[model samples]
Target chain A: MSRFIEIVEVGARDGLQNEKVVLEPADKIELVRRLDACGARRQEVVSFVNPKRVPQMAGAEEMIAELAGAPGRSRIGLVLNERGWDRAVAGQCDEANVVVCATDGFGIRNQGASSAEQIATLAAIAAKRQAEGGPPISLTISVAFGCPFDGEVSEDQVVAIAQEGAALGLAEIALADTIGVADPWTVRKRVEAVRKVIGDIPLRMHFHDTRNTGIANAYASVEAGVRILDASVGGLGGCPFAPAATGNIGTEDLVYMLERAGFETGLDLGKLIETAHWIGGKIDKAPVSGLSKAGPFPKPAE
Target chain B: MSRFIEIVEVGARDGLQNEKVVLEPADKIELVRRLDACGARRQEVVSFVNPKRVPQMAGAEEMIAELAGAPGRSRIGLVLNERGWDRAVAGQCDEANVVVCATDGFGIRNQGASSAEQIATLAAIAAKRQAEGGPPISLTISVAFGCPFDGEVSEDQVVAIAQEGAALGLAEIALADTIGVADPWTVRKRVEAVRKVIGDIPLRMHFHDTRNTGIANAYASVEAGVRILDASVGGLGGCPFAPAATGNIGTEDLVYMLERAGFETGLDLGKLIETAHWIGGKIDKAPVSGLSKAGPFPKPAE
Candidate 1:
């Protein structure tokens, strides 16, 4: 399909959160602005978590406060609990993304909560948002494909979570391959199962490229009628809880695939590669994105 | 479709041909043996080309002669011209794989011929093999997606080559993304187009992960009813003619994707990763295969 697909740029948030190098708030802001300039309409700017737990995601308030709002750009703030939701509201984030886990083991290790407990937390925040009128919220189910400790997350587990999530009237529900263990067939079937249950809340997909199945999974999602996806510039970020967690699908790589295939992502490929290089240098690591290393197709007419 | 998929291991030939450090003949044979032990039934073991042109692919005869015949294992030799085909036949290769390029620029640079000239050479070799009853042969169209020297390769060019190839009654035909510039939708469409022209001829796909679209392209090809695919162990190899040519799609990564999605590949994932590690050690470079770095899904019960 040659339709428009929304790419949620997570380079500043998910891309940097799991990185060892803790970027300065100014550097993080600069990274977000650079990606925004590259036509990232929606971006995950910060995660409202304790600095002790995720040190790299420490500057939620400062990062949000410093970023001058660009028209039509949504700065997404990631939240894990009610406190994180309050922080997102206080920081005036364009939107808030709260996370629930498909497996209890990942929920406990990643956010110090069980799966059921995380859903309860999500329900509470949704109710508060409905009453207090905060930023629109979306729920990401982590380990929706497979788990690091539990392993082989069931389709029933994810669908059941999505069902409970749909009841909350959230803006969106995302199935995340937290450890990148998903296959395309499973992805298509799961997306179908989730779609039958959720009616039309608009499904978003988040995939890690740890095992290199991210692009295949994304392609399956797109074919299964998903229009929104999460990607990181430079293929940055890895889950600290998951062993050998590689970056999310690279924003540049995803753009190259979609644009080449005639799908409009509204993200500039050339600018994305440059942003990858800029962030890669900030982290003192070369971008793992394929487009960043290989350059765009047709050689760009140097 | 949970059908059995045949994965052709090319780590020894296409994988190592463009590498910098040329391995000893014994090492190359060892590498082939390791992959065969991991259930690689058909493998591209060497290329019958001048060592002066491709030093990394030298000692094709010695490597083939050293490999003891294994039951059900077919050792494939890649040939570019009539001389190379003769060498492969003389060397007792179980299969001779001839090359026909989709573009003239890559053919001239990589094989010292134009596209038409390469096709003529392939036709000549096919005729000789038919008359003499030599080893079963296949044709690989390199840079079938895009060329480095000549920008975009059209579907008409590749389909035309496949039509000419099918007329030779070849055992198989492969479409290779030599520069790794293909996307999933294009791959699906092109595979369908080529399949229409080459009736009942088992279509094989070869891809490079240079743009990180290899897994997606492979997934699309499989969805398009392609059962045979070419992949490398440890994600090795690059094209010397194409700038920033990365490794082929890793066999282990492809197997993981297929087996996890309920497709039978008859390949061992653990052994494949070990072979990747073993080969990577010999080359003094880490295997770039995603499964090599992330280990297998479900963590292999470790």
Candidate 2:
């Protein structure tokens, strides 16, 4: 097995934020505690976005405050613009994840800006954070693979955004398959291209299992020298913009594949599946995670 | 696009024969007719197994006789033992598919024999058919990649068995990933091994997408010079012995991949998805095919 790969647990923030039913602050805190107990060192705990636009994320400040007092684990928050960034700094999140979509359509729809404008804003935030000696910031480039409305996002656009973030000294850069349209070859090509431009900054991958290629794409990225992966527990996250998009690559499922292929993921499969089953109980429907339904491979003898 | 790959539609026999529900003979006939209408040149319509054990396949004779009367398509029947060979000969199927499990455990469980014993039986049947000027026989080596009871099947065993089958003058040989446990690296190595042993015989791949690695493995096989593929409509087959094994590579899904990669499959994606939907309705559950759910890539405008 290679050196331990960091699995930044995103289910608490990215997973729950997309749910139609807003979760209570208590439930959000409990979810974070449960994830911490299951060996997740880093977690995206909340999004510091306005309640007017995203009602599900309305109580982000309270959720962050509750989690800040919780024992164990490092917490991060997602932010789209300077308002969210200000809230993230005020909430004292250990890290803040700023996102910029690769295409114009998803950028306008997700963050209310063009790609160029969003990149400029993200660069300014990164520069300001660098100057303030504040908490570290990561840049997640959403729709780096493709877009629902725009279609076929070019590698040049993704490279330019990644290079811009790299120049601003972003802590990490994550390329997201927001619409779940990337194949292994495309993932390998894009990751290599981005790596060439960025020159050795930490790279992460986030993929959706919309067309059932998420896990394979994740492995391909790993083969292309990516160590950090963003996955929701039980594959809970889905893009509200892409109608057919169903789930992200399940955390337990990804761990199973990684552990089996001689990689150290630092996750307990049984406990993660139990967490998935627990979350599934709280949600309206059961998720489509493979490990949850199939259980672990090579079951113990009765 | 490369030359058109022959996708052998095996849902009618391999897909439904293992199901608990015994579909009506009319429904079975209609399923085959619909698959033929969707431009499937070769269809495995039924199995010549004993009804006492496999009751779902009891009406194989009736189905085969009816489909044999149709024009312009090759109708094949899956045969297990000498009794099945007798039945296939009597019914005059366009082709008789003889199966041999690569591992001893699955061979005994599936066909009640050892691998060598099954190969000898197939050789005897092939000789008899040659003497009688009967239709060609194709041998499919099941579990060529890996087995459930016996983990990590060796390529040596697969090649040894395939060499014997090739020596018997079999028309074609297929390597079945019965448990869906193969990765692309494994597929390439194993396919290359079998190709070396069986000189000029056309190789076919039968893969199950249980672990979501099937299409990627199929792509690797295509890159390894394989032109024939076995897919159940709607990704519908699983080995009775391997628990929780579901979703063979769906015909529509596989065609979508092949067509997108600039390979000709001679399949109509629209018609294929429609037929899969029809089959799903007949079974009273939507199939687990990604293409059926997500539609073709670069989805046409509404």
Candidate 3:
């Protein structure tokens, strides 16, 4: 019954982090600024990880510095450990996001720890940030739908993770379909269980269009009372560990479907699609968003 | 809720008609036979229009004759007027389909008549078929959601047209999103209205994936409790009149979604996807079906 949805623009951090090309800090800043201008309030601008491990995210600090204090926009920085948390505080992001993989295989493969250890670290950071009166912390559970190494992640695991995140007093908990293997039924089932476990804590959904069910799953989540969605501009970003995994759901495509389905996203679709095409040209690949390929409905005048 | 859904495969006729290259009749027959082998009971094999007008539909008679005695499959042929209807009867198609455009602009442009005139002609054809003990007649209302030249198409018009089609006692009535301009909201609204007007007469849905809303719209229609759907294998077919128009929703993609959503489509997903890829190679471009591009979910083992 909720009519308003908040879209979290994650192209800069999530998309570019996996892209083969290490985009210049200026390009990342420009992309974030463009997204902000198009009415994106929550922009995951950068991830403060080891530059050696993720060279694509090398300019996190500089990107945050450039995006700080932008009008009517919030800059979100990703923090994986205590060191990353220190960098996020120094960068003065509006919010800090910590991700804990749902499966131990993925946790060790991605964050070099088990899900329990990572959740404990994020809990400590959440406690520290709240006491220090710094930026709020949000928890993202990666591979919430299915894991590449572990395979067939159960809804019970995701619910347990969400309960831990809720007990930590995180502001938001995002269930990520890391490999884009979720269908609508699974999305509904998991969202229902997770919501029951973490009552009153806002739920966010992150989906990949790898199997072309991202939009349908997102719509199901909306019907299940979820308001926050994570998408990337130009459909960039693919999971390196997941086989046949494609990019994240296109922000403009999701926005278009949301608006057409009678939900208010508070984002400009025209500007978002234009930005997608522009950035796609820079990356030297055609955008995979359906709206971009088909153009706007009702056939905009020639 | 209906557990069984019938899929009307239209790739052979609708897809190849609009394609640039002409396929030999033997190839068309092969495609239809393969689709039949994959559990498609309803296949629109060809149209009975003038060969000179539509060079691609030149061998409708030969194609039908080749498929006349196929087991457990009903071959459908399109008939625009008396001549086409005569040809369909002579070809001994299992069913005869006539399309009445919703708007006069489209009706005149596509069928060379007004909506009323075309409806009258189709009604006469239906009566004649019933009296002559010929194939059952089905009506397809093109542009039921919106029109290219006429712009917005009112729900009242569609309801009125459905009322007329219902009066003819046709076997089935299909509401087509001819330009793929429909979203979930519009699909729900139009389907609700049309279903109310034509009670108990089977309703089929035809969706185009132009703006990428086709799959979502189809899902919405299923939630609306419609039992039959029209799809093109390999995601072929585009409207020449509607700008930015794309192909119909892919049969394999729809089957995958429906089966995942717990509906029985009676079609083999593996065979359907394989047939899509095989047919795509014979065409000039890649297949537009998303399932083809992403492969099936769960990666179905190496």
State each model's CA lDDT, in order.
Answer: 0.90, 0.81, 0.84
Better of 1 and 2 by DockQ: 1
lDDT by residue for model 3 (A76-118), tens = 9998898899899998988988899999998998889999999
Candidate 3 lDDT (Cα, 0 to 1): 0.84
How much does each candidate deviate from the true structure in C-alpha RMSD? 1.4, 2.9, 2.3
- Per-prediction DockQ comes to 0.72, 0.37, 0.41
Candidate 3: Cα lDDT at A94: 87
Off by over 4 Å in 1: A241-245, B241-245
**Tens digits of lDDT, candidate 2, B1-302:** 35688999999888887666678878989998888888888999888888888877778888888888467789998988778888888888898899999989888877889888898899889888888766678889998877777766888999999999999988999998877766766787889999998899999998887666677678778768899999988887665654555667889878876675567877788888898888888777677776777776677668
Worst 10 residues of 2 chain B by lDDT: B238-247
TM-score of chain A of 1: 0.97
How much is the lDDT of residue A251 in candidate 1? 95
The complex in candidate 1 yields a DockQ of: 0.72
Model 2, B159: alpha-carbon shift in Å?
A: 3.5
Which prediction has the highest DockQ against the true structure?
Answer: 1
For model 1, what is the C-alpha lDDT against the true structure? 0.90
Interface RMSD of 2: 2.8
Q: TM-score for chain A of every candidate model? A: 0.97, 0.95, 0.96
TM-scores across all candidates? Answer: 0.98, 0.91, 0.94
